[model samples]
Target chain A: DVKVTQSSRYLVKRTGEKVFLECVQDMDHENMFWYRQDPGLGLRLIYFSYDVKMKEKGDIPEGYSVSREKKERFSLILESASTNQTSMYLCASSLTGEGHNEQFFGPGTRLTVL
Target chain B: LAKTTQPISMDSYEGQEVNITCSHNNIATNDYITWYQQFPSQGPRFIIQGYKTKVTNEVASLFIPADRKSSTLSLPRVSLSDTAVYYCLVGAWEDTPLVFGKGTRLSVIA
Candidate 1:
């Protein structure tokens, strides 16, 4: 079984504080993604990395950044947390392939910016 | 990447087959249809994926038509524990990111 673990399940942060959400995958997949789920808006991609030390912006990349210094770990950072930034964050990993590959996701982190 | 559209919500009783359809009018030839099930407070898990025709796994079955414009996910004899939000996604397995729209929220009753 593929296991993806997050650093925190619930986090509360004050406004303008820096927040870091960490994710680690044991499957050794090459693709890692960060997404935020909001009501009615569904899941919006925040950032994704295909390989170590490489990152790409997704649909809603503003107010967020990602770090993939190692192959097994990916971290999402909020330089300055705000009230509107509170949402459920998800991390996923998949293999690098051209066929229909499935992504395994971690238990999400619910961040609340107060 | 192809955008998918599905119903907002659905209700079914235990032991009933639940079939959810997703429409992707502009789906590309290289794109494949995929379904995911997500429970509350948990991340989505992969259910099934298909290119065309039918594909069945232990959990669910995926049916795709010749045109590949639409696909259906069939859940056999669903139970209350199968109740969750189902997302339909279309993308190439390599470079495209799995984009999720507002998924179909399925409520299973006893």
Candidate 2:
């Protein structure tokens, strides 16, 4: 079985603070992603990494950045957290090949920006 | 990536079979239909995937017709634990970022 774990389950931060959310996968998958889930809006992609040091922006990546220094770890960084960034953060990883795009997701971290 | 449309919500009782249909009229030749289930505070979990015809697994079954324009997910003898949000996604596997819309909320009552 594949396991994806996040660094935190709940977090609270003040406005303009720098926040870091970490994700790790044991499957050594080549693809990892970050997404935010909000009520009514659904899940929106923030960023994704295909390989080490390789990153791509998703639909909503304006205030967020990602790091993939190693294959098992992917980190999401908020340059300066704002109240609007408060939401449930999810991380997923998948293998890169045909018919292998089934993503395994972590439990998710609910961040509250006050 | 092709667009998908499904119901907003559904209701079912325990021991009943539930089927949720999703429409993807613009699905491409290479696109595959996949479904995911998400709880209230957890990330979405992969349920099942299929191209055409019928595919069955331990948890659910996927039914797709010849046109491949739509798919249906069937859950047999559903229990209260089956209550969750079901998302139907259509896209090629190589597509970098998967898109998730407002999924159908299935409430299985006892």
Best by TM-score, which number? Answer: 2
lDDT of 2 by residue, A1-114 (tens): 999999999999999999999999999899999999998888889999999999999999999999999999999999999999999999999999999999999999999999
Q: Model 2: clashing residue pairs? A: none
TM-score of each: 0.97, 0.98
After TM-score superposition, what is the CA distance of residue A28 in candidate 1 from its true location, in Å? Answer: 1.5
B1-110: candidate 1 lDDT, tens digit per residue: 78799999999999999999999999987888899999989999998888899999999999999999999999999999999999999988774577888899999999
Best by lDDT: 2
Q: Clash pairs of candidate 1? A: none
Q: Candidate 1 — which residues are off by over 4 angstroms?
A: none
User: What number of clashing residue pairs does each candidate have, in the order they appear?
Assistant: 0, 0
**DockQ for each of the predicted structures, in order?**
0.77, 0.85
Q: What is the fnat value (0 to 1) for candidate 2?
A: 0.83
What would you estimate as the lDDT of candidate 1?
Answer: 0.93
Among these predictions, the greatest DockQ belongs to 2
